[model samples]
Target: MSCDAIGSRLTARDIGWGPNAAHTLIEKVSFSLDAGDRLAIVGPNGAGKTTLLRCLYRGLVPTTGSVYVDDEDIHALPARKVAQKIGVVLQEMPADFPFTVKDVVLMGRIPWRVGLAGWTDADRQQADHALEHLNLQHLSSRTFSTLSGGEKQRVLIARALAQQPQIIILDEPTNHLDIRHQLEIVDLLSSLKLTVIATLHDINLAADFATKAALMQDGRMSAFGPARTVFTEDRLSGTFGVKVRKRPEVTSGFTFSLAAS
Candidate 1:
């Protein structure tokens, strides 16, 4: 099935999160995302990329500011309502589950199901469709714990797709995939029409997959704009504390590397 066009507009305004004023994890970060936009949040470790994503998906509340979905305060909405609007796939997975792959993916439909009812036919169909879209139909009956890292990642993505959310937030989507799977997953995400917000570690992958890039440093936004414009050598080097250089080839797309000091 084609992606539904329920893409939402997400906005963050001067958001700050932390236990106390002296230890802010994310501060004064603001950005806007329109429908059909793919945004890549890139930064080094401890740059608060994950923390910002937590705020966007309402997993963690901001201490000082707000996140809005299509002008509605996300924190004001019910958690189930927020789940209906935004789907999230985090980097970590639960340690153990005795359920089959299909069963795991079907959990995504929880937000849509009525009170205390078993899986309906429509929910099963949606789960099946999501499995097929991710090419996991053949493994639908296999135990989720037996799958490889990349397979688990794909299963999580299939779950998010089954959620049928307006906005999808993925933290380190390509974390443990092999190079080929990484490219394939990134390419697949690029084809979707929904609003996507992902934190990517690979600069080249971010450059290829995202329309816009938000560079974060020390819990603050260092730059936010078109990927090509924001991922310059100077900005990358400054944020990552490494020398960077961009190389353009005749046939291949732009490639980046750490320059020799």
Candidate 2:
């Protein structure tokens, strides 16, 4: 099916895959994402969380079922068209390249550009807006390799936003940040009002930003629903094999917790 038929920003049905392995990495995974919804995906290490994101981001095709973006089958759409609508910030970025922060972020706009022509004013404007959104305006001219780990992560996020996609997928985006920056990124994404799908090891942060949550284990979905329902002590403990406590937030309309999984 074409992406335009679903009217959802992202969708997956019965997606599964495994190569020369005993079991499939992901199995019968089906989900749909409406525009502007935030979904936090939680799973143990090797639970196929990263692999699932890869499939959605068009990095790997599923061995069965299908992935759709805005009603178009991801496999059917051109890569450039897919890039324009779905931006991704991965867990780790490639190193050894000497591009500047601005240079790296601007790469997001390549899909919209033609030939080897110079970047247009609108391109610079979009890149600048993204940098500003991440509060990295001052570091635009800095070399990407010279930045700290957290800074590089934010820059990659900026690059994703520069694409002006309808949805953004972040895989362990907060893996290397201090507490303050981690909270900042979560807050920023929450306020952007875009469809966001994130795989986070930090349950508290996920609960803080997500409107909905999905728990995965053993290559299958364990549970998924509103944050309030999914983050309960019982549900969390059962999934992670840990003790957890949920505390409501005074400002935000959500809760935070510590899981002893």
Candidate 3:
């Protein structure tokens, strides 16, 4: 599927968010992504990767600088317009509502829903298709609250996919997944070929799935480029303040070993 038909390129310029209570979150960060580009944002905890993604998704408006979709300022657009362009899956979510798995996934269609704003036949079909894509078809009828952590995560992603967004943002998407599901999610994303900006903790997974990688440290973008240049030992080690070795793995294209910091 071509992403060109989706919204325009997403860009951030001199973005920063902060307050006296919270230290500077993002600092003069700038980057742009075109359609069909899979860009992974990697950093250690407190590195402001989430803050930067929030700015891009308009979850938190930048305290300084600006964000744009194509050339138009994102803040100026309607929320629905922005929602139509991007879908975000947060690191941790607590859904207490008694919604069914299918009901939860179907919620993604809300953006497309207007006056009548209800799930259409096509929407139901798309929802099922999304679940099928993630091998969650069997769980569609299950209660979301009853599913396992990994199952919930996959279902959430399926919901995002059902949205049919041009760009998708994920915050630590692999948080609670097992090896198989983790790889499955990454592999699925790599195949979708959407404009994906993900906050990933797994360096090797980022290297394997992302077309480009952005290194964030202390609320600033340290490096942004192809995986080969950003995933080097020196860069990863320096950014994380720990030894990270690139090991040849049987399953994954690359793996990282933690050494003395």
Candidate 4:
């Protein structure tokens, strides 16, 4: 399937969130993603990467600053309207979903539903396109609860694509998979050719797949630029507290040695 023209610009303006005066999870985080730009957010655990993501996708409204789709503030838009423009694939998914793969993918059309109406031909067609695009056609009639981890993840992405959003935001797209599945998913994400923003634990995968990169440290943006520029040895070593190494001869290129206890 072809990439959609809904590839609009997404921006954040020093957004922040906190419950109390003493506890800020994410603060002063900012970045901009143009059409067809894939940005990977990489950082150590507890660096507020997920918190920052929540703010960007309107999963939470920041206590400060704003997230924008082109020129309109996302928080100000209706939730349904925002859903029509931004589709999110979360890090964790339900252990079991009581539906077929195609039915689950069709759920992405919920935001576009008219009052009390049945599924339209267009909805089914869009879902089919998503399935084919992600190579999930063979699994369309399978029970979602029976699929393997990798298959489940692919189905979730297909669901997101069925939304026909301008941008797709994924949190840790390769969380529980083995090396092969992880590489498979990473390659699929790279080939999407849509505006994508994802949080990845693997910096090497991030560097290889993303056009842009954002490094988050302690709820702040350490750097934001082309992936190669932001994934340098110094930044990786310092932010992750490890000895980062580059092996030009290797496929993954960058690796790390653990810090002394």
For every model shown, what is its TM-score relative to the native structure? 0.94, 0.89, 0.89, 0.96
Candidate 3, residue 258: Cα displacement in angstroms equals 6.5
Task: List runs of model 2 lying over 4 Å from the truth.
Answer: 1-8, 248-261
lDDT of 2 at 34: 79
> For candidate 4, lDDT tens digit of each residue in 57-155?
899989999999988999999999999988899998889899999999999999889999989998999999999988999999999999999999999
Q: What's the ranking of the predictions by lDDT, best on top?
A: 4, 1, 3, 2
TM-score (C-alpha) between model 4 and the true structure: 0.96
- In order, what lDDT does every prediction score? 0.89, 0.82, 0.83, 0.90
Model 3 scores worst on lDDT over the 10 consecutive residues at 1-10
lDDT of 2 by residue, 127-207 (tens): 888898888999999999888877888899888888878778999888878998798888877876678899988888888
> Which 10-residue window in model 1 sums to the lowest lDDT?
248-257
Model 3 local distance difference test score: 0.83
TM-score result, candidate 3: 0.89
lDDT (Cα, 0-100) at 26 in candidate 2: 89
The TM-score, computed over Cα atoms with residue i paired to residue i, of candidate 2 is: 0.89
Model 1 scores a C-alpha lDDT of 0.89
lDDT of 1 at 191: 78
Q: For residues 142-247, what per-residue lDDT tens digits would candidate 3 score against the true structure?
A: 9898988788888888888888787889999888778888888888778776688898888878888998899999989999988888888888888987777666
Ranking by TM-score: 4, 1, 3, 2
Error of 3 at 46 (Å): 0.2
Q: Candidate 1, which segments miss by more than 4 Å at Cα?
A: 250-261
Off by over 4 Å in 3: 1-8, 20-22, 248-261
lDDT of 1 by residue, 1-261 (tens): 334555889999999898787999999999999888999999999999999999999999999889999999999999999998898999998657788999999999999999999999888998998898888999999999999878888898889988888899999999878998899889978977889999999988898999889999999998998888998878888888777767756221344456667
